[model samples]
Target: MKLLFLNWIFLITVCYSEKDGKHLEVRERLKTALLQDYDKTLIPLMNSRQPVVVELGLSTMSMDLQGDGLLNMTNGNILQWKDARLRWNPEVYSNITSIRIPASKIWIPDIQVYNAVNYGENSFSDSLRNPDRHLAIVTSDGKVLLYTTHKLQIRCDVAKTVPGPGEVFIDRGQLDWPWGKYECEISMGSWTYSSSQIDLKPYLNRNYIEYLDQNNSPYLFTEDSFKDENVITCTRFKCCADLYQMARFKFKVEKRGTVTAQGLKLMKKDDKMLLISPFLLFTLVIISIIGTLFTISKLCHRKPNFLVE
Candidate 1:
């Protein structure tokens, strides 16, 4: 019993030491030291020639399509990049591994949704403009992450994607409406800088994409979920060499509360079977009744053949 008790005490100490939170004083000191000489206007690269490697990924919340070739996508953007200016030694501040500061005090990539339609309630440009509205998490090794939600309204040529059930489209004019799959592209990149300035990259994995511990993260929308059915795909593209470092996210959105053509056909066939089954049963019953009546009439007339006893 004594040995078991000692073992439990040791385990408690080890667990507590692994994930300890720091004090406010420790975080404040580190923040002041880092931001004192930080320049928010300039890129955080040590060498001017070296490109700032920015990692970007999205967690799609929901997708909705409109009748006018528009696709509304609600997504969460995870943007992270190393800042040479935000580095600090955790030993100086109570073994603090990370700190949070107002986003206004740091430099962030001027990312913009290139294919945005700029429609109502979609202020993509201003989403990242006001830095004071968000907080930046800076690790001891100078990694900065800005995790926030973004609403995107993109223009998709739905005519190309409008081939419905039993549809053989040879021309765009034959495309139908309100009942087909729609494909849309959300292209994001630095608005003011070229590819040489900001080198764009995708999230390292689900961990960085969630910007939290994968196992314990509350935000359930994940990259693995999208990969299951080709719902979302992220690719890096450029118009030419040295152009803007853009990443295009292409995904398909189905019509609201609708099923596939094969499914619709299956339902129709099922309905027809349902409608015809009772009639078939009734016909069989009527034929049986008529045959019984004919048998009785023959018996009544053939009585003289047997005997008149």
Candidate 2:
């Protein structure tokens, strides 16, 4: 009896040990599978170095009287100057070429010259009056791009004249009003510098400022020489207005980081079952131990011989 009891205990110990080993193997397998899935989904983003195509939209207008004379002196006529230019820095990005962007991808602003004096003036009157005016995109040494070479036509408005004593006019009235709008698209291919990598996290929610420089001069937009210095800020994939004077603009980066985050989320979700219910696992272990013990007892105990008459 003593020997039988000892054998039963030994058998139960062996069986429980084997069950624990199997559980550990299963846990390891699950961990490996999770890692494999993560690699398949997110590893490409970390290793990829391909060039990306970026679309840039620019729109701006300027209305400055060319000469020193007031609009009223010109009898409701004035020489208004409207100009816009696009530029970039070559050191940060390369291979900046103009691509033919489709109309659907371009945001065409309402190019209109408004005048309070003329209530029913034709909208296309300015374009027709100035047949030479046009928008052009010029590429320079693969560094800068210029858009809207021709000047815009704008009409001025003059205030009503009021007669005073001695035939003197109280107010000559206001001269031509300044108003114009410009919208255009430029496409460029870009990649990160070989020595540096771009971190898109900070720029995701905020605008990135690009300083401008003249194509012929080294002076930056902030300098006094570049009086028309305008800064362009890129929000996401779109940049509008005053982009010409900026030295460099930021391009929208792929959302690979977001993809990686999503992958991690999925991994956690898939492993949740294993991580959440420790109590259930404990119950399984207990049941396994009980099963092993019962098997061992049955094998070790000999059935009592039935003395049949």
Candidate 3:
């Protein structure tokens, strides 16, 4: 009976290994078939003129920097769309419903942060367009998902956007400084594709806004939401009768105690010295008066010593 049990275990392990080998073979074949004639530069659409509908979602991995009319955020962009060219019959491939592939292997939408700071053609900008940032999951039905995390440099108009007490608006862009609340609205879309090439939609509104290091964050998201048709690229830009599909996110950021601590540490040495100027001047005046008095007292008490000298 013991010998029979050992044999049974061996048979089961062999079966699993055999099944795994079959799966690996299927994956390799699928990859080759999909890419053998695939065009990575063109849009994966059945017709050339039809716009590809791309569902978009975003969440903040970290609040990297916010000041001087600029906001930098490490954000996760959830992009999903269907590509008829990538579809396959799962039955032939061991019924595998999904497979993972590097994003560089396929043609993806040319999405851009339209309002990004330094939105120019440079090395940093080129890096943003690099497909290395994402690893996509392709489904047997031709649906592809690419979740990409990027450090977005966006234009911030916190001074004008903040609401509430009038005095809060009086302080320059930084009145809130290490304190107060500010509004940051970010717009994203294909800068070159236009609405004709792509139909952009915000798929998950508030779902992806989780802060990775909440404890160390200098600002808190006071108001965050994925708005209804009310806000998803809802605000249109009319140019030459062509509409640009857009995704815009509005975040209300308030200062945390950590910001104040950092604000002091970041203060310039010159600025700190200037802060104590009045006190330093007062101390110098007191010392000067004491020294003058001591000198007078010595002269009054040492007339004989002066004559000997």
Candidate 4:
């Protein structure tokens, strides 16, 4: 027993160390990205253009983690900003031609989430109707892969994938939590969906999904797991209407809440509107004071009182 206890302690220490290391690495990268101009890394080809313009929004049902590491949206649709001028000049990347993301960039582990998928008597057709529509799994590394009988394939980073029965995938992020939703987006070719518009406040306190958008009503689980026609029914959601409306193809919308190990939500406090900045706030106050003084001075100096009397 002593030996086992020692081993467990060692393992925990190692895990903690690794987690700290990863956090440090992320912090460093973020710092570098902030300090050094990203344009410096761009190939010359991109450098010739005017200031690089980037329009960032919370993609539908997605979140955007800003450089400052703030959680910025909830709804699946919110226009963050119009073509905002990029801080880095575009001319620095003139030598670069094109950028291609490698598969290794995505990391998703296949872990079976208990009581997630639910296969019920309800027909698949009732969910949605489209061959292109199928269940896809999300991996730990933020990659969403389509589920098949054999294995999952990592499609484009932002491509939409349909869900199927007994097919469980990781949710890169969910739409619950008090502060706000996760920050990410789905960029399909030229289109983008932001999460700034959707209401994800309902998902924070609960673990199992109570409702799914596709299903028009509430979903109830019979047991932790169930097998129907070789398909497993895992969880249920109530009032799941229009869950599949965003998909290009038609699919069943089951009313069920989310079932995942981690309930994703933002804990940090977000910045206030423009008035929050000390400099801006101070400036505005000064201006208001000056204006008030000027008005009072003008009124005292002349025309008003004696002429009116």
Candidate 5:
């Protein structure tokens, strides 16, 4: 009976392993399919300037200084001052047009945009064409800027996209490039302006704008959803020659429902383990019952064992 119980446990383990293996296999295939499908279904729309909904998530703002004599007053110094702040009403930003994506369903793929001719020629001609033109971010004060910048860089964590336990599709081609870092420098002359304040806004509107891609192809899309009505106010400090300052902003915005339909179907399929697990449990119960009955019967059939009289 003990051996039978062990065998049953082994069998259940094997079944679970088999089921999980199948799920892993399907998920891998689905990831590949999702990447291809995104390139097919959404990439064109993105390139064509279709408005893709993005949810405004958490955001951060920071500022610092660089260069020699930042706090000192000296001759022939390049005195520069920079400050960063975000000016967006969270309530208003959330109320803006958006799609309800199960928090887990959103993913921002690691997007790489290579100049059309500089990098090795690839088959995805469209991607190679003006890749940077489609990617942009809105500041708190209604300014639109490209995701790629020389002094400032912004990036969102791939892990943060799926926070909860709910299953979500890979949604590969889609991207949610968040503001990662911002750095600036000014040199050559003594400090003229005392201090400069930059206001960043997060708002999206329905206004359409046109831009040229890397390939010089024309495209249009609704302007940034995150918009700020106010502008940054700056106060000049006492003139100093060798003053320098730098600023950085880090923010997270939810890019909801970027996944394709086919990818969603595959995600649901992978979660079918919830349905299949009950049957597996029932099999284990039956095995336990048989083992108990066999043990009882063996005891009952034992020859009457009386102390040798």
Candidate 6:
């Protein structure tokens, strides 16, 4: 009976793997279609005379330098159209609400921009773009998204436009997840970001957000039914990474017809850090032992030696 049960388990595992593979193929195809559609529809909007400004609300940022964990962005920034929980000291917000154009007669309303994130909750009303400090872009649209100095970098420039759509390539940051170290590449104009080695498709659903660790292997759904049993709310994982009290955020799942998200999640370092290489750990242990021995020796030498009598 035990052997039969083991065999049954093996078959289930194989079946799930097959199912996951098929689902991944569909996701890739959908991503490609979205890219094609975006290229055909939105590329022309880049030609406007008014500068396009991207506002990535602080709520979506993965790392908060300030203890607030949300952007009280004190710069020439704009408010997001959607409501967010980020607190603002009137003074700090003053810097973002509006920008002064030396002699220009126009005042642009700060527009909220998104990085096309899929794994976690990233709200449309966030106060900062590319909150994880992992994305960057350059474009002919003349839109700028404000962020801290540490995260600001040029990833690509809009070279030219084509009949179908303009092309854009942005740099992605190195993410250290349980899988390993790899770089992510987000191609903006095409509207797809891929880290072939990461395989984030498994965590695309709401229930699996924070629950996706090495253990408790969960399954992913093949279809795009937001009302599926897989959709869930992840509110218990909120934690902070910043030291200065300037940023803050919250998380919630939106269930209308299809399961969708309407809020942002706060950042928290996980136990993945515990998975450092054995060689690195060994080196640290050796250094610690040596330092302890040296301290003991110094203390013994300073004291009177009774054994010398």
lDDT of 4 by residue, 133-230 (tens): 34323222222332211111111122123478865554333322212222221211111111211112111222222212222222222233122221
lDDT of 6 by residue, 31-112 (tens): 3432342322122222234222222222111211111111211122222211111112324322233221111111222222
TM-score of 5: 0.24
- How high is the lDDT of residue 108 in model 1? 88
Across 221-263, the per-residue lDDT of candidate 1 in tens digits comes to: 2123234322223334465444566676554554433334333
**Candidate 5, 242: how far from true, in Å?**
40
TM-score of each: 0.63, 0.17, 0.68, 0.17, 0.24, 0.22
lDDT of each: 0.66, 0.28, 0.68, 0.28, 0.28, 0.28
Per-residue C-alpha lDDT of model 3 across residues 11-128, encoded as one tens digit per residue: 9999999999988999999988888888888887677688788887776655644557566666677789988889999988888888988889898887777677765443224544
- Give per-residue CA lDDT, model 2, range 111-180, as digits (tens): 2222222223232333323323432232322221112322323332222344676654322223222111
**In model 4, which runs have C-alpha deviations exceeding 4 angstroms?**
36-309
* Of 2 and 3, the candidate ranking higher by TM-score: 3
Q: Once superposed on the true structure, which residue ranges of model 1 sit more than 4 Å away at CA?
A: 1-22, 119-122, 161-175, 205-242, 256-262, 265-309
User: Where does model 6 exceed 4 Å of error?
Assistant: 37-53, 56-309
Model 5 misplacement above 4 A:
37-49, 53-63, 67-309
Worst 10 residues of 5 by lDDT: 71-80
Q: How many residue pairs clash in each candidate?
A: 0, 15, 2, 85, 22, 23
Clashing pairs in 1: none
TM-score: the better of candidates 4 and 6: 6
Q: Residue 50, candidate 3: how far off, in angstroms?
A: 4.4
